[model samples]
Target: MRLAIFLLIFCIFEYALTVDQTNFKTCDQSSFCRRCRKVKPDNPKFALVPGTLNIYSDSITADLIHKDNKHLFSLKLEALEQSNTFRLLVDEKTPLKPRYKVQDALKSAPKPGSIKVHEGDTEFTITSGPNKAVVTADPFRVDFYQNDILTVSVNAKGLMTFEHLRPKPQQPADGENAENPAANDVKEADEIDDPGAWEENFKSHHDSKPYGPEAIALDFSFPEAEVLFGIPEHADSFALKSTSGTDPYRLYNVDVFEYIIDSKMALYGSVPVIYGHGGGTIVPKKERIRRAATLMKNDPYTLVVCLNSAGKAEGTIYLDDEKSYNYRKGEYNYINMKFENNVLDVNFIGKPNFKTAAWIERVVIAGLGRIPKSATLIIDGASQELEILPHGEGVAVRKPGISVQQIYNIRLNF
Candidate 1:
């Protein structure tokens, strides 16, 4: 009778809860993301005057202009040791202190191959070779090629900008300060050249931009491809949409409540990943893995992103001619998220949740018997079931109605 009663109770609780709108966040909650998104065209932040590109032994660097502004700036075009990807990064490596890197939430990064640049096309180049292809430093743009065919391109619209890093000047201190009484007044501002460059206000929020403005923007185009995806944390479609009539894809991460789907708003976690599928029809018997889904969507995939700091990013993908099946995410043209733009501007941590790490950290408490180690507990499935994870060794029983409908995270603390 006791067992039956217990069984009756546990069934009432299950896991499989559908994600809703309130479970994520927005731009206002994130400090740095908000700061970067507020960047305007004439803010002197886009004042990037072209500087000379200096070629290093295996790398390159340049002195970028702050565009008649007040921020210190530099640009780096470096080569990686094993990574096949070329890096274009602009950031304040050394600031008033240290900035943050939010790269961990991302799954992985792609390695670019040794590339070749040829100038026979528009602000782009064609890259092709054995087991690899690329377009390095094309004039005004960069392009990727696959098996002697051009695939993806960046800066096609020439819409690229990098926000520089600058320190907030100290406030005037003490009563017996300076000879110029006008200079003794404290000034905090946001808009460059505006006296309010040291600080900024948005709604009820005020940001102390100690390491002022460091946002980066770039334009990417996929001429023969469509159905671009990634830049998650939104309640939108897996296939991204055009930002022409709306706000540009928001990248800020926040703690949002139950979220609505098909919207380009910011949410809890973000994956700065993208996948481009070719749009044209393939000849019969020809392999169409990379460009297959794009053809189905009847549109090409174009993507845009912003990066800053020790991290780097490359935007081009080419598939080999081989017919091997490397279909990712259970389908052709699907991509596993590979994040390289590590820009976690916040240093905040979440409360202790063992379920988040339970798969890897298999440590259990001692001094407890039947519930101690290596035992199987049957959990009833709601609509479906998943036993991907198994407890090491413990024998325990709980209220009878155990179900997967509401069991993604269970906390059994001692």
Candidate 2:
């Protein structure tokens, strides 16, 4: 019947294509997010150039002047000694050219820790091992810390903007002279009053920005974080709400189609990775029941875990290889979980390739609130004593030989 009415009109045009928040964009339609949310923490035209700070051995550069067009801009602050992770980077210390960076989105190039620089006068601190960052200078900020506890702050709310790169304004000949001298030297090299910095139209579609307003805004906060989750490919709601009167979580990577769930829009995959949980004090149930599970060798991987209401938990493990990036060269496989005083350790290193395939066939272990009539499994060191299952609020420790060399030592004694 004409191929069943062309498969029923392609399933009614793929269920009528959803998600169209007016085709995405707000922050007053993004002229550099409306000049970085109208930058004002008493913005006396920004600062931070006193002595231009340096401190290297893995990053911390400076120079950010713009006291009304003194214009200098460039601030970096790396520190990722094997993933403790912190990277700030503002741009344009010198640029009439080179800008656009988002390249390959990092999977390497970070390892460089052991820092310790203190300077102090208007702010400068960098410590490393229990983390610390500081770096203030009048209106420019940076914060971040861990053992001193304040975790992440960047541009505190002055909304660090950086739209520099100009030249494109000459149009004055019909008897020429509105102020023409190549349009007043491109209006004195575009001094930002920003009429969308030379062309933008949106729905009727225009955009001609042509490398004129480089656009880069900042604002990370987190402070004492009472829950904030990853900026995933949003259909929204794995708990991340509160943008204080809407729209501030957009990560940009679109292709909406059926998206309209809680909606911060921008869907179809964009992992900017945010995660912050109820902050400070209370991570000493011997470091909250020590856990270090690392099972990587990707395959439909996703492990979220954000239990707060004070059971204090934090988790994020997303392996990949949906078809191959070959886990980027190391190939991959390793899981190490350690539970402490009540004992429950696991360790499954790699490379025994029995033709690969079997990155953990089964292992459940949910919250475990109670219901421990009995449980003890220790493969590779041999010992088995299982039988416990209520599996609702918690309690379901199933297990079945996780692959590669394998060595588990589970022991839940409740």
Candidate 3:
């Protein structure tokens, strides 16, 4: 009798719950997103100021000016040490107050790497190792090349926008100089240009935009990319699709009740990194197993795993330390071990909840010396082919979506 009552109550609760889309704000409702999206195509507005380029050993600093507003912003380009990575930062040259910056994203400050600069009449070329970044001055654009091949371009779409900080305009008194030219101009501009600059309302919630408008936006282009992925916390496909006319892939974190699939809306968390790939080729049918095993043996996987299983599963294995920890305090020791038959066996814990599956996507294999180009999965003594797509210096393993509450004997041999 008690069990029957519990089951009846569970069914009633599940049936009563439903996702209400109106609770979340869309791109049109967001004043900043709407303003940024309205930028015309291929019309550049920002340029590097002449005689303001300051070149350093590991970085370059310059002043960028907006064509219409003439707003000045500081630009810094830095190369990180021992890694083929570059950082770009832009902010107002002189703000009324210090702006808020993200914190604790990195373990520590990265040591600076050496950079070679080749100044040109209209552009600046900075090279680190075999990769180079070409910065065009007039339009303020950057193109990145790996091994002399065009890989990624920054601000290439001319959608870059940075709202400068300024004091709020004072309202004119009802009777005192109602036609003052300065006050009239300010009032006219606010009414004609910004609709939600000071405040906005979404349903029952109201937002007093204390900062007025301080949104930053930029576009990154991958010319030869076949698939683009990342910008997580979305119930979407493994490979992201185009969001051209609709709302963009948002990166805000919010509690979305029973989120919809194939949607770019943000969920409970966000990881703002996008990876583009174009050099993935299918391995031959016969040689897939051998090539995969070899690649797996040469590298170590160092990221998250989203396991899919039906019932309780158990397995164990041993691996040599990959030397990926802080060893300066004598807390880490590197070791080398040879697995039985030189094969690494991995066990995964499955998450049967449908909503959680969308939150956890691919398995990233990192911290190894090099990323594997291919991967092989063995389940119940049968070979299952898988692709090892590249994500920066790591590899992402993706498989077909599996339904929840299914059981199978899964073994990974990489």
> What local distance difference test score does each model get?
0.41, 0.62, 0.64
- In order of TM-score, best first, we have 3, 1, 2
> On a 0 to 100 scale, what is the lDDT of residue 203 in model 2?
88
Candidate 3: list runs displaced more than 4 Å.
1-15, 187-192, 280-414
Pairwise TM-score winner, candidates 1 and 2? 1
lDDT tens digits by residue: candidate 3, 47-79: 999999999999999999988778899999988
lDDT of 2 by residue, 311-394 (tens): 333322222334567766655544444444434555544442223443443233434444666767777678887765665555
Can you write out model 1's per-residue Cα lDDT over 99-150, one digit (the tens) per residue?
Answer: 5665665346644334444333222232223212232332234454433335
Error of 1 at 99 (Å): 3.6
- TM-score winner: 3
Q: lDDT of model 3 at residue 125?
A: 96
Error of 3 at 127 (Å): 0.8
Native-to-model Cα distance after best TM-score fit, residue 130 in candidate 3, in Å: 0.9
Q: List the candidates' TM-scores in order.
A: 0.44, 0.33, 0.66
**Quick one: how many clashes does candidate 1 have?**
51
Clash count of each predicted structure: 51, 0, 2
